[model samples]
Target: MKLLLFEDKLRENFFPLTLTRFTGDLRCGALKLRQRLEALLTDDEVSFLIDSSIEDLYSERHPDWQINLIKPGDKLFVNCLLKYSPTLFDKIQTLDHEQALVQGNALVAYRSNKDHGSFDPDSVLKQFGISTENVDDALYKHPADLVHDNGRMITYDFDNFFSDKDNSFETEPGATILNPYNVWLGEGVELKPGVVIDASDGPVIIDNDALLMHNSVVIGPAYIGKNSIIKVAAKIYENCSIGPVCKVGGELEACIIQAYTNKQHDGFLGHSYLGEWVNLGADTNNSDLKNTYKNVVMHSYNDRPPFDTNTMFMGCIIGDHTKLGINSTINTGCVVGTGSNLWGRDLISGYIPEFSWGEASLLQPYRIDAFLSTAQLVKQRRQLKLSNKERSLYTSIYHRYQENQ
Candidate 1:
């Protein structure tokens, strides 16, 4: 049995992270969805059938995989792959148009308005006798759904929610543990006396060498990557992923920060994702909700009328090596491409092109030297030496965006 994880229309719902890879690659609940599925299907041969966009990116890195194309009668197993539930396997095994409910899975399946048949690996999923469905009603699972509450502590699969263990655990000066047991503190990690972890419900994991300074409050279902630091008085919340070697603070929720980004100050960021080597200045915030509860509209590369994202809570997507200035307020569903620098006191609008700079009424192209200098500074703060390969990558990004400018 070959397990094929297809990148369905959920790609639009999961941007920034999905921009680089498939949905199964997304990490959450102490494990990635793909990895979890692999564990369950130990006897099967598992692989991915991702979007053409991802195929394009991975092709250059792994030439042999270029043959990994969607073909007719491919016999693929189709899944949204955005969120993982224990019952997902059964659901995929028996999904159809009329009798859609599979066992105990609560996820709703609806009709997909987009024509995914052209792009979807339909034939591949058919091999399992589990053909794909174009359902727009596929209700996304929230992080809270995975949690199970135990009176003493919440035990979730391999991870623990809030437990009495955190209560008995000692904290250094200035470290505050709000909702105990909700967070996992890895070895060599230090929590400055005032660091507050509010794992009132969900679990928070502070990986090895992570430090939370005084006055930092981290809510449940949060992950602070290895060797990262939470600066003083940072207010972080649930469903946020702070990647390794980063420094973060401010208000963040449902945001995934790829390795080595910094948002170290006071700001409100919700429903967003950031790529590697990005930085957010003090008071830089993103809007997750709109005046009306209507679906969020996002600006794409070719589409002029902001694309309908279906979800009302969509936020911004910042690509790799991007930087933003202090007091910057981003509009909902904005997409900031790789290597760009944005700043201003005013609220910024429109899609920011890759490697372009600023969006305060007038947008400008960022100088490579200036961008590199900032990148160097960020690396230094994290006490990391910039590798030649990374510098070369940045150089390539600089040139690639220069063409667009």
Candidate 2:
């Protein structure tokens, strides 16, 4: 049997990430969701059926293939699955609709309503019927899920602790692997002496070049992205995905920091997803939940009608190159657009437009000087200067959105 991973309606929900690849290319657990599905149905040949609109997204990544369509008298069967769970896949069945076998039983079908909406992280939550408390709930079923649940621990083992297991490590002298069950160290990684890693229950993944400084207590199911650093005395919690080349410290939990973002401060950030090139100031705190446990709503640049996320624990979805002020407090379900230079004491509304320069109130145009300065900092951090073409592209975006000011 042949299975098709068709991209029909979930296109918008997987933007930016999907902007570079197909939805089947997305990675959640140790394996890509689509790969897991293929493994489960090993007897079948699987192929992706990408929509024409998203075809360009995969042009450079995957080779072209003939996509099958349901037609009259076709004995084909199709199943729509969610990246979050395999149970959702099992619930699907094929039904004959008109002359074709329609792939139905989707928990959320593609809304044929002319008012089909655009993508926003929080809005996707409402469509999926997800509550913020359950944001990482599906991921909890991963082998690493239990590792992120209880958090990591640090205990001194005077004797040398050695692991015969492949991909295991014993860092410098005096460092201990108190709870090995919760910690999963990737290949070719090392640790220095006096370094402490705690894996009480949740799984901790120290990816390649992920350095744990002396006495750092990193909790489980927490991913220190490839080549990132955890400074001395850092505290990292579960449900965290720190992407490549980041330098982190203090505390973090249930957060997704895309590549090249930094939280190198003594602050608290929970239940958030930071885009590329973002920098958090020292002592920055974001409210993940309200005092009242009502559903969270998020507004975005491309979305209309404030949408419900059905989640009480939704935090912020910041765009690229946005910086937060020292002691800055972001509202729940806040969506800060790209190239925003936010600084000040006032707590602004959740939706801050792109290229905005402001102090929480009385915001204005972020002049070129400020934009270039931050851009330069990002360039230096990433070890690559922005090309003139890239600069021109950003300039175009800035001018286009300048009217929003």
Candidate 3:
């Protein structure tokens, strides 16, 4: 059977993160949701159906499949945004076309054949003669939902990652491994001396090509993704997901740092989600827990009421390509949008709009030309080119932000 991942209305709500990649591409555990799904369904053929705005980009990333191709066979359509339980794949494999698995109002997974030509989700229910059943699964519809549940998700992924495995990677002498039973290592990983890994509380995974510099301390349940680097003396606490190709340092806890970002200095980043291509300058920090310990509230577009995130540890949600200046402070529950360059001495709070500049209480819109030029340079530094599709995506998001204001 073939597996196809599809996005839903939640795509738009993802905003700054989905501005570049789809919901399936968002990194939560040690792996991207797409990667985890692929790993779980290793024997089946898999592909993605994402937003049209970034279709070409996603296609280029996965050129083996076509965006519109719905093959002539039995297919399983899976919602890309659902936080899948690794063990659920075993149950999913046992089911037949007689039943459909859904979570709440969202139709998460269903089966149909070539006789059903339409790829639209609404068509699947009517086309297939299957029955629907409500299944309890975590459905993520908003961006902050990632930050709220990342720790638990990371731990879950860790268990699925190494429950039946041994130390598959190499470690250097003098590298201390506490509770070795809970540590999972990937091939080609190098741990320098003076590094300590404490896995007693939960599982720890260091994926392939991840390097831990001397004196770094990694505590579980934590994840260091492929090609990522943990700089000297970095304190990575429980429940953090550091994605591929990132450079991390200082302290991080219960946070999700997406791919290609750099936080390689003394900084305190906790309970946050940093999108791709982000750069946190030296000594940057954010307030996660409030002094009063009240619930954190986040305001976004669409004139909705302030979202009361019942959690007390919600940090910043920084969008893609945004840069924070050295020593810049982000207040609790702040939402900074895509392509913004924040540089100043004051602490940032509340909602900062897309492509914005200047400092706290003195904000100004960043010009289009300046934003593009900097974006081009940033991509170049990472050996990537800013294509017309990316430029169009940025333009569309900029206008949407303007309209929301």
Give the candidate number with the greatest TM-score.
Answer: 3
Superior by TM-score: candidate 1 or candidate 3: 3
Q: Write the per-residue lDDT of candidate 3 for residues 162-228, one digit (tens) a residue.
A: 6755654457988999888788888789999999999888788888889999999999888898999
The better-scoring model by TM-score among 2 and 3 is 3
lDDT of 1 by residue, 1-405 (tens): 344455555455444445555566555544555665566543444446666655545555556542244333323243545344446545644444323332123223212222234433333233333323434333343211111111111124225232335434557976666666456777788888777787776777787799888878887767787899988888887767676888898777777766777888889988876777888888888887888988777764433355676677867878777878888889987788777887877676657876677666777777877877777776787677655545565566567556666
Candidates in order have lDDT scores of 0.61, 0.56, 0.81
Better of 1 and 2 by lDDT: 1
Q: Which stretches of candidate 3 lie over 4 Å from their true place?
A: 86-91, 94-98, 122-130, 162-164, 168-170
Model 1, clash count? 28
Ranking by TM-score: 3, 1, 2
Give the least accurate 10-residue stretch of model 3, judged by summed lDDT. 114-123
User: Which ranking of candidates, highest lDDT first?
Assistant: 3, 1, 2
Off by over 4 Å in 2: 1-81, 90-166, 367-377, 385-400
